[model samples]
Target chain A: MSTVEAYARRTARRGWWRDGLEAAIYLVAAVGVAFFVASGGLLATAPVDHLYGLGRVAGIVAAVLVLSQITLISRAPYVERVVGHDRAAAVHMRLGKVAFVLMLVHVGLILAMSARYDGRSILAETTALWQLGWFIPAAQAGLGLFAIVVATSLVAIRSRWRYERWHAVHLLVYAAIALVVPHQFLEGSTFRSGGAAWWFWLALWALAVGSFVAFRIVRPLWLLGRHDLRVAAVETHPDGSTSVTMRGRGLDRLGARPGQFLLWRFLDRERWTQAHPWSLSRAPRPDALRITVKPSGDASAAVRGLEVGTRVLVEGPLGVFSEVARTASGCVLVASGIGITPVRAMLDEAHPACTVVWRVRSRAEAPLLDEVEALAAERGARLVILEGPRGPGWGTAAGETLAGIVPDVAARDVYVCGPVAWADAVERDARAAGVPAGAIHRERFGW
Target chain B: MRGSRAVLVAGGCAAIVGAGWAASPKELPTLDLVAPSSPAASATPGATPSPTPTVSATAGATGASSTYDGPVVTNARGDYQARITVADGQVTDVQAVVAGTPDAQSVQINAVAIPALRDEVLAAQTWDVAAVSGASFTSPAFTESLRGAFEEAGL
Candidate 1:
């Protein structure tokens, strides 16, 4: 690489890190300001019941923001480009975590303040939750769903087959967010005064919905209209997995890398409108882009019959997982099942010191195992294939299995993609082996 | 914003302030008319024959009468007499005797109301006249009693 290219690469990497740091700072500062405003006793002096009301409203906003994040991430065609999918996912996770904490505080404060006013025991008030009004229980349900999503995403539960199931379950959070709106508007006293409070709520709702419509609906449609791409070839591996090559007029200038996914909408009359996320199995080469898909769901099933000359819509160059440079002496790339797609893509451009640990149920299920092995051999990197049923024995029983094979695993930066359970288990195992949480990165699929 | 609601709010405020300023009770007239006879003369009407009896019986009277033989005035028009008591240059009490049948409930007035009114008037206190809630008319009557006493005392 030329000196300027090298400097530009380093600068871009630093910018991503800096963005994450700045987001964290802004979140903390906003929370601090909210705390000061709440604690200043101004609300207390106001005749209206203050803290309970504020808590209720904030809870509703938090819920809405959470849903908006999910919708934006799930449906945005250019999400990877706009926020870089991996960073966007991280931001979503962090914000979701913070929102959960705030919701807990909101509920606790509301209950406490309500108890103070009505001279009722906290236990009694909680038990009377159903009687408090329909909104209370609805909000509680939303909170419950939020907690489940966070808990399931933890490093422990994420490493199993259950992770895939949980992905579908987590989508209910959008429903939960929708449920809290009426509760906020009807029960809230702040909205009644109709000043800054009214405008603030209205603006937040508008911005959130506007972001959803812009990123998910408008941007995707615009991209589809501009780039009339068609599937040039469908290459199926021995393992029944497929890579659909899409060729378009301006594929060269698109400048996407391997490991990033695109929301591909095939022009098959039955499947034209449906959009699904698929990872780029190979580096973006001249003339076409390749997206590997495993026939897992309806979207994937449609790719089975995809023919040449079939027009398709591509909304991508997403995910920051590929761009995050491996600066360590040695790196570990853990892939389970179809999670190997991004890992394979990354492996193509990876430095020589990186190791590929491919864990699959059996040798038959190991798609692209030979290609990855060839790459590992060429790069002089260790490639360990654990062929067995998905269980504790497959590096999940203890951190020692992988750590035993590669003692330097503790020191290396680890990137994992797979079923939620496997990813989670790998993360747990890595952490147990003294890997720092920041160094152990993961991207959830199907959620 | 320039609607009926705004007009209503403005009207309500104006009404409250106006009512607060104007609701104070007015000064009552003093009962200073001279009695037809002195108490000593009334105690012994047999010693002197007055032109007429000082007390007259109404339909429901229980036959209680006292004679007053001092200066007397009688006419077809309604006769009015008032008795006054004074002490230390202040009118302490006044009792009016009119020919017409007086409402029994209106015959007695609380002494405190008269004294309170007297003090308020003397001090020129014009704000928030403290009248009894249910006995509003009695406040004016009490004021009149004070006036009569003040007149008798030549204030």
Candidate 2:
């Protein structure tokens, strides 16, 4: 192996192990913080009933922090470096799923406990206390929105349709996180009393705001200052999508891989100052990097209009969906809709030992199908197209369902992208067919 | 410094004006002729020949009446009934009798200021004597019922 490839392998291996350990440590810290805060005896000699109420509120706040910590840590700059991009991302996505579950429990317990004193149905009482009531529903809505994003980004969901579109929609997770803030402040009893509660809340707010600043603003600005990549070429596909090729002085030295995405902040007069994640469709070549962005959202739509020489800020080489990890003897690649962007990049590298399963609603909707098929043919990997609905008779033609078609699916590692639900379904199906949980990997395109 | 001096002069003038205001009685509706009845006058009966009970010597020294009096009657069963009467805002007589037991003394007030006192007590606006201890039920009820009758009699 080349020195670069060896370095990449070492980094990937260390990251895989460290990511699990870091996540575990963070989990313990989060739970410990919650338990300590909930043991309200340290504060005051309150009436037993009042103490119980106070303890319950403290527990809720702690739980929220635990979740917020998971989200924040998964996206932390240092943590990302240690875990590498894609492995860090996998941890981030799984933690986010767990956080949503915790958030649900926190909100439910809060409403139920609050109902005891208010002497009305939880809904009715909350409505009467308008400010407090808003938090419960808002938190619920935020969790629901997050769940939708996660569900759609699942492997099975991404294997079906436009991966780019689902990826763009998945950015709503940030908005969901933002929505949870007000509920924490308004309804949280801990916030009412100052001192420890005040500091705790302030710390949480700072962490959340700090993460946003780091991810959305600070990191982008830092990247812009250090690396100046200009648009080298803009290739428009027949499917109303365009790819912007960025070339810089030291693009290859940045050590980005195919299938790894970057937060592209274009510096055109019209589309400047907006950051969006785009998959690096082509592998890192010296002085040149290519990101194929489908004309889906505000940022991507402007990619086609960018001047050839316009400067752009690239914040990543983020995401763990790259082929830096162990290469299986046989692999099944699933792409739903626009989720094929990353898969296409992976296939471009030519892992001939892999089997590509491209799922789409209609043959016409598959934008990169020809290129994907051509790559598959060139690499000598088996290509299977599961067209239309796979109903009760779905598995008959393929001799089994998508899961069954790949009998070695359990043995082979799987990478999924697209809508959260698609990923979830695919992961669920894959696991059911005896796929080891660790082998079935996924990268969520969520903000 | 000038502002401070101005404030100090203004404060001095205000203090002088306050002193003058404090010195003046300022007109108030006179209740000098109608004085508060004395406890002693109310306790005695026919102590003076005047229709209004004589102001007690001690009351005059204190600038207020010392006693109050009304009426007293006896029932056929020898029960004592002290019917206290008042006229022209002064207690006139308090006739008392003991019919059977010394402990069971029945007191009544059919007097001028006494009726107002009774009205005030029964309305629970005030208690003339700190509510009678150990006889809370009987004492207040008896006093309150008599006060009601006194108010009806307009004396």
For each candidate, report its DockQ versus the true two-chain complex. Answer: 0.01, 0.01
- Which parts of model 2 are misplaced by more than 4 Å? A1-46, A49-60, A63-74, A77-215, A295-302, A324-327, A361-365, A386-400, A403-405, B1-155
lDDT per residue as tens, model 1, A1-447: 664456346646655554443343334333323322332212232344456546654564465555446544654543454455666676677777777787787888777765554345787666555553687678778778767767767743456544336556666766767766656655443342354545655665676667676766676667666666788898888888888888876665655676677777787888775667788877777667777778876567568788898887766666656645343446898888778888888777777778888887777878887888888887777788877655554463333366877788887778888877667778877888888765676666544
lDDT score, candidate 1, position A178: 71
Interface RMSD in Å per candidate, to 1 decimal? 26.5, 31.7
Computed on C-alpha atoms, the DockQ of candidate 2 is 0.01
Report the C-alpha lDDT of model 2 over A1-447, residue by residue, as the tens digit.
764456457655655556445544344333333433433322322233343344454445345544544544445555554465555556555655666565556555545544443344777644544433566567667777877876777753557546456756677866777776675556454354354555765675676667757865676666565556788888888776787787777667666777778777777777664667777776777778876666565667777887888888777667567765433545677777677888788887756768777676667767677887888898888888766754343221343455666777777778777667667777878878887665665776643
| CAPRI rating of model 2 | incorrect
Instruction: Supply candidate 2's per-residue lDDT for A269.
Output: 72
Name the docking class for model 1. incorrect
Query: How does each model score on TM-score?
Result: 0.53, 0.50
Which ten contiguous residues of candidate 1 chain B have the minimum total lDDT?
B99-108
